[model samples]
Target: MISGFKLDWTLISPVYCKLRWYGLQFGVLTSFACTCLAAIDQYMCTNARLEWGQWSTADVAHRLIIIMTITCLLHGVPYLIYFNLVRAPIAGEISCTSDNLAFRQYHTYGYLIILADAPLIMTCIFGLLAHNNVHQLAHRTVPLVNVL
Candidate 1:
């Protein structure tokens, strides 16, 4: 909202620029990770194997979420270090960009793969696995008869 008013905090402060990009990546990655974790949790819970079902407990879910949160935060640290406000000579336009050339390239390509496609693929895989597991529940120790 502040940015909508043309009072961009990132433009005013370098620290804000760093933190803005860092927080953006952190939030995006964390959301995707959590969603992937949920899909895996569903697969675990639906598995016919008792050992796999045991891992679907609330405690395990909490731990996994925490681990993912920390991992995403760590992954975003590079954005904090690399992203900065760069001045363009053509029109004196300032843009938020990465300082390192390699990191910039990675941000473009790697972000698409790591932050976009990977999670969707993981979610689809585990979702299908869970569906298959549900179908096999009828063969487990506790019988699950198909509904008419």
Candidate 2:
């Protein structure tokens, strides 16, 4: 959230002339993706039973970190290329903006996919799976009756 605030501020701040759009994009996407990965991890952990072949939380976390890093790097390339601080003709003020129209549209679509679509879908899927797993586990457990 703080990264998001910084990105928002950088876009609007008049005094902030230079913007590292790649870093900003990478940070934002990585943060959000990692958050979703964490939710998936929680669901997996909750559903895991005492099995020998099951993956450990540490293993899962490490894999997720690697995946998130690679994804962020891949997605951040366009921001690195197209985003720059330019002076507006009418206002004579500098602001962060994209250079190429086509690339900008592609980048916008990428953001929508990564930030909105993927997260929402993943969250719902994991949440429902976790709920069902918990319900099933609860039903399978035998309730002890106390007889005095």
Candidate 3:
């Protein structure tokens, strides 16, 4: 009976660990993406050029919504495919794990690319651009009084 209990514990531990690990991964990725996107939107709204045309706030919001939706879907599909619970060898026990090693690797790489690398690069690029624009604007002198 004691050995059976130990076997049950061994079988259950992996499932719990996988659940916590993947849960943290998903949570961190989602939150990071959201925060970065929001910061990007805020920076763009304040510093964007409207030389050709003007965009309404609603239009900008819609575009952002579409972008976020696409990003989530792209990141989510691989996770859905590879992350799942499987029946363990022990009867009535299950384990949470990746369904495919290749898919899991792909998902990890994709997460790093989409959630970490891309966002960092974009934020830095846009931040520099916005800073430059603001600096140039501040330095430009406007005539306060008309010279006859």
Candidate 4:
């Protein structure tokens, strides 16, 4: 018993496993939040009157679509890669106080984060589609009343 009590591998392993899972969940949540923020900022820039310009409604929608696409590329993609590299492998190996286990859990968290960002990418795709439809409508006829 290295730690004063008889070391129980079965008892400890489950705790480590849970910690690793929780770490993964945390990472996923963090990544999702970052993605959402980027998308929301772009949405606001495009649909809200937060920017300094007297853009026509069509111009606003066009700018928003462009901004959202750029933000997705610039922020979401790298975050996904970074998270995967740092967090994926130790998905169920972390422990409460074990250093090696903790490291693995942390890495597993990084992976989950990247995986979670998939939804944000999808959101960006849909946003682009919606923006394109609006743009086309603007050209062909009266613009939609609400473009967001």
Cα-based lDDT for every prediction: 0.87, 0.71, 0.61, 0.49
At residue 87, give the lDDT of candidate 1: 85
Model 4, which residues run further than 4 Å from truth?
1-12, 51-122, 129-148
All predictions: root-mean-square deviation over Cα?
2.9, 5.5, 6.9, 14.0
Give the TM-scores of the predictions, in the order they appear. Answer: 0.87, 0.70, 0.59, 0.32
User: Which 10 residues in a row give candidate 4 its minimum summed lDDT?
Assistant: 78-87
Candidate 2 ranges beyond 4 A from true positions = 1-19, 48-53, 87-94, 143-148
lDDT of 1: 0.87
Better of 1 and 2 by TM-score: 1
Q: Which numbered prediction scores highest in lDDT against the true structure?
A: 1
Candidate 1 has its poorest 10 consecutive residues by lDDT at: 139-148
Residue pairs with clashing backbones, model 2: none
Error of 2 at 74 (Å): 2.9
lDDT of 3 at 8: 43
Candidate order by lDDT, highest to lowest? 1, 2, 3, 4
- Alpha carbon deviation, residue 143, candidate 2 (Å): 5.6
Tens digit of per-residue lDDT, candidate 3, span 1-148: 3376544432355544454555566667666666666656646555647631244266776787678656665555555556667675668656666778887686668657866787788778767766776675565534323332
| Model 2 poorest 10 in a row by lDDT | 10-19
Residue 113 C-alpha lDDT in model 4: 56
Best by TM-score: 1
Which pairs clash in the backbone of model 1?
Answer: none
